[model samples]
Target: MTAVLATLNLGVERHGPWTSVGRSGIDKRPVDHRVQARTWGLEGDLIADKRVHGGPDKAVYAFAREDAVFWQEELGRDVGPGNFGENFSTTGLDVTGAEVGEQWAIGDAVFEVIRARKPCRVFAGFWDVPDLVKRFIAHGAPGAYLRTLQEGSVGAGDAIEVIRRPGHGVTIGYMLRALTTEPHLLPRFLDAPEMLPKHHEKARKWLAARELEKSNP
Candidate 1:
């Protein structure tokens, strides 16, 4: 069976107390029509925190519907597609365990997985769960952040074909762990050349800090 790119969602920043303009794009809702997939992101999608959230490297955020099901069971609440502010909600896609450089052909657009999503305050606030950031880290289904390699229109019901797999064995799941609880596994994250440049730099910084601490202590 083929994986389905089930839904496309978009949202604009709303007024909040978080930033000077209080910007957040977490209130994504499903679009009934095709959305234009561009190099930066879905056309008309408003990203309040462009500095971190939206860019070429993270042009699209994809969450697996299976992971959403997990959340539904854990929270004992309804979690539907686009509930997590992801641009793409997929069914049957193993994004959590995918290689960093995996390529996907979704409708007319092609994307390459670059890294994993890291939970932050904006996400926690959107869910109204103060400890959500911590909880999400523990859950560890951070999803895959993909870069648009070929831009075009992508809509719901598109078939997601894995065009290529990266040379590294570093799955998004393993990468999330290495960057979080499994600090000692930093070396593994470092070894993956397909990893997002910022993430690679972060792991190095973290490892360097640990070494410094050990030396000082």
Candidate 2:
């Protein structure tokens, strides 16, 4: 399958009414030039909240244009690139279905899918939609968060080539569902070792709770 990077986005720091800290880096906009992709994130992108956003495990957030279109119809508005605070707006990419640990090569950088983008209050606040988080969870296409494996320059129109795909079947969609609405699917995350440690911890807790329930009942 052919996938392309439609746009490269960089966030700017802004004070917003809905943000807890009164400041957020959710207002990302498209950039024209090639930007440096570092271990933490794309250079020049503002990451205002380090507590939950921007880390080695969540370096680059990718959202597919196809997925955006789905939202556009539901929202009755143009869900354009960078509107979702994604660093990489992709076309012809099955980002939601991408397996955890799947490696994609774009420009000179290699990125490994690590987790799903969990919708937060900042996201809903950015869009000014009160129930967007709940609706996004219901939609279940939370997009993919990647960790940089090779730092290099990346630009819009870069061809995204899938270099590796783990057969574990733990996709961003499945993981998001497991993490959110479906507790039964949580144990399946164990098959994907490339998943973030926090998820594995959640899976363990779910299992322990289940075991306790079974013994007590």
Candidate 3:
């Protein structure tokens, strides 16, 4: 199945009431090629990482497809690349199922799903929803963070196809849910060999804690 973009959204700097603030221009329907050029031309490759600004975290640069829904309903519009502050907002593909190191080809560019994004205060500030962060954590829909594996041009209506899938069966959603809801059970989820490096770190921490408990007891 192909994941079609139901909405695309974007935000730069803003703060206000949650519902009202969320209804801004950040979430709107995809514009024609002309509109895309004016509002989202920078979204193309080479400039995709411009937002990162050399932060320690890579998640800052991009967001996954599922997270765009919040903006979609908020703005009462079909948001896409130009609206979501993302260089490439896509649909049609199970993002949660995308494994770390696996590559995807969208139009002429290629990107890798690196890890699950961790929402920051900036998101809360933008939406003006105090509980937004908590809700994101609770829902564990942090969305997938990606790195540009290959750079090229991309735009709306472009077909996204999975070029590879990791041998590991665990999905990004499965790991995020485990981390958020049942952190204590994280080790069990790491049974899959394909778990990403971050998940490996979590598993190590859990094992260490368990070992400490055994000795202390």
Which prediction has the highest lDDT against the true structure? 2
What does candidate 2's lDDT look like per residue over 117-167, in tens digits?
889898998898999999999999899999999999999999999999999
* lDDT, residue 36, candidate 3: 27
* lDDT measured at residue 52 in model 1 versus the true structure, 0 to 100: 80
Candidate 2 minimal-lDDT segment of 10 residues = 13-22
Model 1, residue 132: distance off in Å is: 0.9
- CA displacement after TM-score superposition, residue 106 of candidate 1 (Å): 0.6
* True-structure RMSD for candidate 1: 2.2
lDDT of each: 0.85, 0.92, 0.53
Sorted by TM-score (best first), the order is 2, 1, 3
Query: What does candidate 3's lDDT look like per residue over 1-217, in tens digits?
Result: 6754333333343334533323332322343341122222324222312353212224213445666687678546764554334444566666666665566666566666656655555456554566666777776555565565555655566677778777665566666766677677677546665446677788889889999999999
Instruction: Arrange candidates by lDDT, descending.
Output: 2, 1, 3
RMSD for all candidates, in order, please.
2.2, 1.0, 6.2
Clashing pairs in model 2?
none
Residue 72 displacement (Å), model 2: 1.2
